[model samples]
Target: MQKKSGLRGIHAGWYAVVCVLVLGLVALVLYGSGAYDSWRDGRSLDQACDGALAQDGLTSALGSSHLKAEDGDDGSLAGCFVKTSPGTGRAVRVTLRWSTDGAPSGSLVWYNADTLGVREQAAPLGNGWSGVVRYDGTWQIMVALDCANQKNKALVAYGDLYGASSGTALTGLGRVTTETAKKAAAQHGCQVKAGKRLTRVSTARLGEPGTAKPLGQAQGSCVALRDVPGAQSGTPEIMEYPADPDAPQTNCYLATSAKKPGYGLYAYYGAAAKDFESVGFGHPGGDYVLATAPCPRSTHEAAFALYRLYDRDTGNYPVPHYSDSFARSALKAFAEHEAEQRGCGEVRIMSAP
Candidate 1:
């Protein structure tokens, strides 16, 4: 009888253990399923925010007259525009926004448009947020929804929609007032005024490179020059085409001496008909000579030839002057001219000195 009692007690203990395990499994399953509903609600909110952000980007683009709305998939949100400038080449700016609502836990992610990968993530903002993105030669502006309770993520993606513009930097003043934000949005469109000034000669030094003249004395039509302090050694070497075996190509070598090599400027010119034929500067029936040379090193170096082959028969001559104070102006003018010749409308200038 005592042995029977011991067996019964052991069986009761095992039954209690099994009951606890079954209850724990049930609890786990309930929590997992219950959490999904909340996730779905959050995801719905995220989709709404994405739509709103997309509208904002489109409104900014259309209202500013920078782009026309293109046909897209139903419920899809995207917009873009093309811009052109005399100095800067062509570029397109686009904006895109998307979201995920089903994840229960709130999360926001920022992505680089080119890679389409997350660049940042955090809790959603209460009102909205914006980011600037660059891919290839394009620039994008992205804005997203600021969720109140859950993490609602939105994005404003801008593409380099138009040709290049003078000012390349995309500034984010973070959390600006609606009016200010609207102005910034308008800026992304073609209606946005151009803020970058092209390279020009100093008014006071219009005809005088060596002399320090009054600020207003320089010419307004001058080209922008690039500063190459160690160009003799550090400057990129110029590459020449096979047709023009004797023509100087764009080349730069760093100066090895302690004393920097005096600045070497180039005067770009379109050769005359015979000269063009002799050096292969121009094709058959082309009137302009495509040539560049080191500018004469002088304090008073005032003028450099600027030429453009408009067509086989016509060419343009825009004289780009040089000034010590406006050294970059000439370089910019020449670079622009080169871009135009190459049929490139946009150019990027790095801020590195």
Candidate 2:
């Protein structure tokens, strides 16, 4: 009888063990199927930034749909950052910032360094979007959308995409930024005429040793200085982007030879121009050769500057020479052409240094 009791107890124990295993499996299946939705990751893209951002452009760009978001607000600045979940082979981190007074001071400085210098090129985000896109080991974009109702307050978006290439970066980040901007505008009750949807962004070629072409055969904005006597000598090469009045800034680089030191000729508009003028030693018409124009369509004036290239190693000016008067003439031609495109009044060249 005792033996029989022992067998029965063994059967009961085994049954209890099986029941526990099955219950655990059922719980896991319920969670995976979202039956326990409350336990899911709460920080989703739709919930980030009070639902100001969307996953439309980011999913394909980052090659992953499993994303997480974190947002922050610091009175003057607000931002939302999105990234892929851990263990995803496709890694991406994108941050979008919103501000009424333009980008932060540090961002303006970085923009000047990245776009105006010879390191990277800046291209206009076309299709009526007043913004610029650039790439240098990563992608950077800044867009300014005017708000009619919110006078003196334009909705500006600054986006940075890491671990993504040019094609996907431009298309994906550009679309996402535009979408977010429009959404934010609507949510804030700002009357903004959003631009047409963007499928692609312009190409911004980075400066490299083999990319410089002869000044004699230069095209785009560099053509203004192609015939100058100083630029005609030696194997002077030019790195240039086509004139883009839609862009906040434009640039031209002149190199004595391939991979050698050079100088920069650039134009800044809107808040960037204001920032350029406010900083130390960056004032126009004094130490630097510059010109100003009244941009009627924009809230701020436009500035065109000719400045020395900073040494790659030391980050100090090597100060390439050409002739101030000749340079001024070429710059005037360049500025006038751009001003015409922007529908701006008189291009006022600054006094010689």
Candidate 3:
């Protein structure tokens, strides 16, 4: 009987030991099968959250008053706000970058209170890249990844910035102001207007047909020679004459009319002293005149002459003369002035006559 009892106890002990060992094996199998690794592999949520939080901290450090972040798919992050940097006025800037391994590719999208649309992405720079879409008006930006190989993936980062009204990134404000002033002067009649109609003249003092001559000699005693204002700059007004005797004669004469106190330096021409008479005396006929008046300076005089010469040679008025050296110089000055007036960078002259 004693032996049977001892045997039963030992059997019970063995059974208990076997049960404990089986339970330990089950636990080991469960642990090894990755029940915990599923959660570990899915820890991308924690990484994304941490990234967003870190970006917020960085933006705050940069003096951004309003900072916000949002999580996106595949380890992407985005943020936006108004920056407090001085001189930046109500401006918006956006940036996006993404990376991928092997054949990595990604995309970015943005929307504001005004417009919502997918913007075109620029080529990536460095490991990741940043770009600005619009700076002056409303803002939008997008980034993308090149996933050439399906095995590769990407992480996208995006940021938007708004600020106060800052001036343009270009230069030359002074030039623009000066040009505007000049235009205003012209409009106000601070300069003389070019003649709309010409007078014909006939006289001996005038040079032969098709020949250019001095106006002071052509007009003689009929009109007094007077220094025209705005001539100091070498842009003297010229008077042109026809060399033909039988053709309607004309004398070149500078206009002294100054409604706004400006002057036109001009030259006159005639066939004979008598032809010069009508022009100087404001006669109805017998004078031929070509004139350029009320320009900024004499540098443009040669250009004007070349323009007329080109027209005469080509049988076309206002012939374009950009290739000519004289025209180019004048055009350069004009372009600079224009750029100054329009508040733009260096003005480029595409074509001129």
Candidate 4:
């Protein structure tokens, strides 16, 4: 009986030793896989933008669980440089800036891209967010949030990726911009119309002659511009957003050839309109014509412009001059059509200077 009892005690001691060893192994695995580090570094990136940039799903997109921020400032603009782990072969570097005047205050040529690629038409990020995204080799996003009391200004979050990227990375960038804009608006005491959580966005990057159709068969975006002169001529194409009035800005690019853009029409409402006029963009002159109409969303009038297309190399207007008379007629038609779509009244087209 004594020997049997001793054997039972020995077996219990061995069982306890095995349990401890197994637990130690499990802990070693967790630590080695960096699961512990992930928890520690999870909220690190949020510190830069005043807790505006959410780190959720960014780790997977960036392919690193570790991130750091180098905070910066430029005049009134708040900026940040976000990077992946220090020594990773595949790294992502994103620079973000936000301010009331971050967007272009004045430019007839507003088709801009941060990355090194041909500029393509940007698509609107729907789901109640007033923003547009363009992807070339890299991506750029701009979100304009309207203020309730400060009608003349808006909080704009603009950001672009600098290095390696993927579809997930694009979505992650959108998340960063959206979250930062919302947080900044709140901090500045702007009762802004908040956007919903961004789950998905369009990746379409259409270049010249986008979504083309014969002018005779014009519909959708080109329908409003169909009555312009030479509608029955060589293939003309257009690119535009779907009829959406709540959007703060609208773009329409009309191309007379398959190779190049012909005319660029733009509408700026609310804060964007203010930004446009503040920098002498909406002034009637140059190779472009201007128009204005009152909009419900803005305390001031919305501004529109029709710019003549030119060759980048020579900086000269296209051959045949495309006619100034044609430009005026086209501007009037496009302005009236766009104003009507936005529920605005009486577009007052300005004479060319």
Candidate 5:
């Protein structure tokens, strides 16, 4: 009887050990799975949250506000308002949408994106991209992204940031905007990263028809002249936020050469020069011996200078004789281009001195 009892005890001990081992294996598997999920969550947060939380950056961009997205508008717009507190009224809202069809045209995208690129490079983050997008009435930050390895879709962020003019505020909203994009990156396969780059305006000037390549579009930049030693080149400079804020004043110098003993060209911006018809460009009235003309109904000015008062090499010049015709042609083409791109009104020609 004593031997049977000891045998039963030994069997029970073995069973206990077996059960312990099985439970240990199960716990290990669960822990491993949980650990893997945690890792994935961290990575996912990096894409959307990391860049948005730069408190000390130049823009002092919007940090993690714990925003939650609900169903967006019915018209291809998926957006969420950043509430002041959970389940309460909202303060700021950031929203985004992507579309393959009915997307903004490439040139239109280029026109609007060019300005924002200058305004905000890192706003809050970069998606490995270089441009932005815009719509009518309100100014917003936009980006072009590729979804699902196919060349498709654009990302547009609009903050109802009306009457707000702080750079901090602008970029703060921008950060939220990009964070929203990162959250969608995985679902849409927004494979391409984004960054900022200035839109390049082509340097080629107006030449004879069919001979010279057309100049690249300059949205908010001044296509004016900056002199180098050997040959003339186009120097484009950002003149305020023309496209983004739609600043009223802007100019484009069609052509320019070096100082005296060289050649030169000039253009009028949003300046109104009177006495141009009576006094003329070369007359003793204004600076640069530059011809002036009324822009008529358009608030923007019009005029171009080929051989201003102080031009040198007056003897062996390439384009000689009254270049008014030249200025007219260049100005006409530029005005037309602006109308086509920006819907600027007619630039009726007035007389030159």
Candidate 6:
């Protein structure tokens, strides 16, 4: 199945954490060199959701008429996002599939808020799992199948989201998911066991918190990111190390809420060196919004700093700016704090590392 796609509570088992920490750093360095962004150019969003309404089994089964849909593939993801005619409020419907055929090991199969769990109701998708997740005013009905074709094995999931009041919400969506899973199973020649239900997942095991949550509580190395002055809280971004194992993770506490939209407070621990630009921010003619200083520790320290980018061309995020003074000040404050913690040098206009 194709579909796509953190740190901070990182204090226990120092040795194990360090190894993973280094790996995480290596990944971030590559990311800094521009290996981030999982979405690659591909079929237009329309192509991704090619048969959304007309060809989908769920719509007719659910008695959803006059519904509208849009779908597409973004390198790693492919699916349709739908809303009823005159879609309004939080009510919506979505169908997503990872476009990638070969997902690397350790890739996540389910994510987003209000995680899904299994409940017994019916068995339609022969040989997989069925679950449901309800949150706010919306709910998602999900199904996954283990389709193996002699050699390669793939796990594919199908889901539907809708208001709880829809008549066939349960029965129809479940049947549609089962039908879709059957088609998918046959496509991959994998067996599906009818009526097999997943064990209930505990509420205690809510979805894993990642960058989408508040940066303050999101995980990080050394110290968690505290609230920044004059900034609305935004999600922290965790750059994972793609090297075989996790190590040296880079936890970026974004102050995107910084009266400006692109300010981010990046912290990375586990062995790493500072690049000249990061190390040379305060000097004449260096980056205007970027700055960095070495974290005091020889092993685990926050040495990297960056002023996150907001592409005006995409008009994606609100345009943001951080004065050279503010950026430098933040870096200086961060470095001084690190020195005190690691018993290193007094913070000054730090020299190039």
Q: What TM-score does model 2 achieve against the real structure? A: 0.77
Measured against the true structure, the TM-scores of the candidates, in listed sequence, are 0.22, 0.77, 0.19, 0.73, 0.34, 0.30
- Report the poorest 10 consecutive residues by lDDT, candidate 3: 111-120
Give a tens-digit lDDT track for model 4, residues 161-267.
65677767677778777777777778877778877777776565545334544555655445678877764453266655565556666766666565345666777
Task: Please give the lDDT score for candidate 6.
Answer: 0.36
Give the poorly placed runs of model 1, Cα more than 4 Å off.
1-67, 72-75, 78-93, 101-129, 168-353
C-alpha lDDT of residue 70 in model 5: 34
Considering lDDT, which of the candidate structures 4 and 5 is the better prediction for this target? 4
Cα TM-score of candidate 5: 0.34
lDDT of 1 at 138: 32
Deviation in Å, model 4, residue 19 alpha carbon: 28
Off by over 4 Å in 6: 1-63, 72-77, 86-137, 150-152, 163-167, 188-353
Deviation (Å) of 217 in candidate 1: 40
Would you list the C-alpha lDDT of every candidate in the order shown?
0.27, 0.66, 0.26, 0.64, 0.36, 0.36
Q: Flag regions of model 3 displaced more than 4 Å.
A: 1-132, 145-154, 165-353
Write down the worst ten-residue block by lDDT for model 6: 112-121
Candidate 5 residue 288 C-alpha distance from true site, Å? 27
lDDT digits (tens) for residues 105-140 of candidate 5: 221232221111121111212333322322233335
Measured with C-alpha atoms, the lDDT of residue 30 in candidate 4 is: 85
Pick by TM-score: 2 or 5, better one = 2
Instruction: Pick the TM-score winner.
Output: 2
Please write out the lDDT profile of model 1 over residues 95-114, one tens digit for every residue.
Answer: 33233312111111111110
Show where candidate 2 strays beyond 4 Å: 1-28, 32-43, 74-77, 87-102, 111-117, 149-152, 164-166, 202-204, 227-229, 259-261, 278-287, 313-322, 351-353
Model 6 deviation from the true structure expressed as Cα RMSD, one decimal place: 26.4
User: Candidate 4 — number of clashing residue pairs?
Assistant: 0
